[model samples]
Each structure stands twice: as C-alpha cells, then as structure tokens.
Target: MSTEKIKDARRMVHWPGHMETDYIYTLGIAGEKFFTEMKNSGRIFAAKCKRCGFIYLPPRIYCERCFEKLTEWINVGTKGEVFTYTVAYVDVDSSKLKEPTIYAYIKFDGAHGGLIHKLGEVKHEDVQIGMPVEAVFKPLAERKANINDIKYFKPV
Candidate 1:
C-alpha cells in the first residue's frame, strides 16, 4: 500500500448525533387500568399479588418476586411522604431555568411502589427528605389519564 493511502487509512473519524424516531406506547394491562381510573375517577389502585400479598403502585400485572400473577387491585392512599428529593436548577436540555423545580419520590401510605413527582406550594430551598405531602390532582375535565393528572404533590 502507498504511504499516502496508509495515512488516509489510519485517519480517525468523529461523529456526534442523536437517534430520531416517532412512536406511541401502550401501557399494557395494569397501566391502562391505573391511568383510566385516574383520568375517569381520580382514584389510585395498587395491584396486589394474589400469592404473596405484594402491592405495586403503577400496578404491575405480575409480581416481581414470586413471579405470581397479580390480579387483585386495592385503592392506595392519596397522602404520602417524600422518600427522597432534589431541586433541579437546569432543564432537560441542560439550560438553567429561571425558577428551580423540586422533584421527589413520594411513597403513599400502604403502597409498595411510589410515584416520582414534582413538589409545589413550597420553596425549592424548603424541600426536605421525608416531608409529608399529598397529591394535588388536576380538575377532572383537564385530566389525560397520565401521571400528570396529578399536577404536583404539596405539603399536607
């Protein structure tokens, strides 16, 4: 091979880009029920494993542990506490926002799985771990059968 050809062969290349695609997701059996209930009745249901009595929020059709099929559904309390939290000073695009947003892992009483949501009606500087909070759902007419149906969690 020619020296020039060898130099060209050894040349390195750099490419930076993002993958783009369009798609829609169906939230499956348990998800459909949960979202439908939220959108239509403003209620939350936890799926309880028939075999081991494990309850899952954003309920699952099957148990994570015993691999048992979960069939029974029970209502989960609207009130919960902040399991963990953080104040986001930047947006998803990594740009700084004018106002900080507080995000938290809110574990409702009696539910095994918890919801991750934004905290409102409190200062970003005031958010604390394990703070008592309650979900503030949006008015029924405005709900869309998604977690956003609850606008945010507020101090209880």
Candidate 2:
C-alpha cells in the first residue's frame, strides 16, 4: 500500500456515542415465585419433580431429566458447600477493585441444583472447592425479588 493511502486511512473519523433506553421486565412464572420468596422472607425455594424427586434450585416449570411439570416447592437450607470458585481481580466494567472478589457455586444440602454467587468474609487464598458456606441475605424489606437479595455466600 502507498504511504498516502495509509495516511488517508488514518484520517478517517468515527463517531463515539451510546444509546439511551428505559424498560421494565417481569420474571417468568417459576422465577417470579422463587424470587418473591427470597424478597418477602429471605428464604430460598426449589421446585421438586413429583415423579423423579429432582429438586431444582432456581424453580423450573418442568424437570430437565424426566420432562415432567414441577410444582412442589421446598425450602433449601442456607448452608451449602462450595462446588467451585474463582477470584476476580477486575470489576465488570474492567476497572481494578481494591480487593479481589470471590465467586462460587454453592450447592445446598438436599437440593439437586446450586446457586452461583459472590463469596465474602474469606480471602482469595482461603477459597476452596467443597468448602462449607452459607448464604447471607439482605433484609426482607430491602430485597427486590432478585438474586442480589442473597448478598453473598460466606464461610461457615
């Protein structure tokens, strides 16, 4: 390529902008009730498959294994084991945080599925798979029917 052609390419201007929008969303049937329980009572709920006895952490309309409609709800224990974990050095916006964040999959006792959330009150070096942990939920009045209602999982 000629130097003049390269120079012309470098001079091309691009617009920098972002779109602004507002919206409201409703959680689907199963999610609505599951999250509502957390918001109202600071409790976790799971759906049980009547046929196979499979319990899903995030309530589902049907069982994935048996393809059966699930309606039974059960309260899952706050205490669980860390199935997996990761230490995040950077925030979601690509900014570095003062302290690294620990995230993990917490598998509650007697529940088939597990919840993925942040881990707190523990150091990155101490975080380990299979560690006993418990969910720390925000107060009922402060909850808004979302996963954030349970702030984080902390070592027991």
Candidate 3:
C-alpha cells in the first residue's frame, strides 16, 4: 500500500483548541544599507528631516513631520535613558517567560523621541523612568536588518 493508503487505514481524532497557523512570514528588506552600517559600526542611526529637523529612529525613508523624503542619516549616541517601561510576564509567543521581561522606551542622548527595546541585566521591579542605559548589539554574523539586531539595553 502507498503511504497515503496506509495513513487512510488509521483513525485519527482532532482535539478542541488545537490548531496551527496556516502561514507565517519573515518579511523585511533584504539589503538595508543604513541598518547594516549601524550594526557593523556599533552606532545608532536615524533619519533626519532636513526641512523640519525632526529625527526618526529605525530611519524612515520619508519624514513624517515635513512629509518629505529623507536623504540624510544621522548617528545617535548609544547612551540613553529610560523614558518609560513595563514588565511582561509573557514571552513573544504569549507564553509565560521564564522570568519577567522588562521592556522600555529608551531616549537616546540628544534625540527627541525614543526607541523601544528589551531591558536586561536588572530586575524588572528595579526598572524605572530616567534609568540610564545603553544599547548592546549581537555579533555581526547574527545581525539582520531589524531592530532586534541590537539585542537589548543594558545598564550603563
């Protein structure tokens, strides 16, 4: 009998609340030159609105303030302070994390707004607004054109 025929000969049962995702995708630009530069150089980069002086982290291709295409990239310092934070008991998949994860909005030195990232090396309860922190990046080989390339923020 064929493999399909063999499986058809057996009975199977489905369980309630047991399902699988039909599709999942890992989508992003294959070649993000700016992000690559930042990761390899260990410097944070942002897009600046030449018209309005508004800066955007994760470097936007266009300026939200002036509605103009951004042509210039600026380097932001690694040193930052926590603007706000929250402690999450759940992991990315919504399952309980081994330990609570501290997430924070980190305002880089001299930047207007902040970037969100995981906060590490400190207890979740101890994370607070105005806490000084800095970016910690992964090895070059492990980097992707994504925010997660900067692994997490650690105490400065």
Count of backbone clashes for each model? 0, 0, 0
Writing each residue's lDDT as its tens digit, candidate 1 over 1-156 gives 434444443364646677999989997999999999988888888999888887898799999999998989899868889999999999989999999889999997887868999999999778888899998999999998888999999998
Indicate which candidate wins on TM-score. Answer: 1
- C-alpha positional error of residue 79 in candidate 3 after TM-score superposition, expressed in Å: 1.6
Better of 2 and 3 by TM-score: 2
Residue 33, model 1: lDDT of 94
Enumerate residue pairs that collide in model 2.
none
Q: Write the per-residue lDDT of candidate 2 for residues 41-104, one digit (tens) a residue.
A: 7778899999999999878999999999998999986889999888998988989989888889
**What CA RMSD would you report for each candidate?**
5.4, 3.6, 8.3
Q: Lowest lDDT 10-mer window, candidate 2? A: 1-10
Off by over 4 Å in 2: 1-12, 17-20
- Per-residue lDDT over 1-156 for candidate 3, one digit per residue giving the tens place of the 0 to 100 score: 435443542354544474676874543332275567756887787778888988877677787777998878778888899999999998778999888888899987655676899998888877789999998989888887568888899988
Query: Local distance difference test, per candidate?
Result: 0.88, 0.88, 0.79
> Residue 64, candidate 1: how far off, in angstroms?
1.4
Candidate 3, after superposition: displacement of residue 33 in Å? 3.2
lDDT of 2 at 14: 60
**TM-score of every candidate relative to the true structure:** 0.86, 0.84, 0.74
lDDT of 3: 0.79
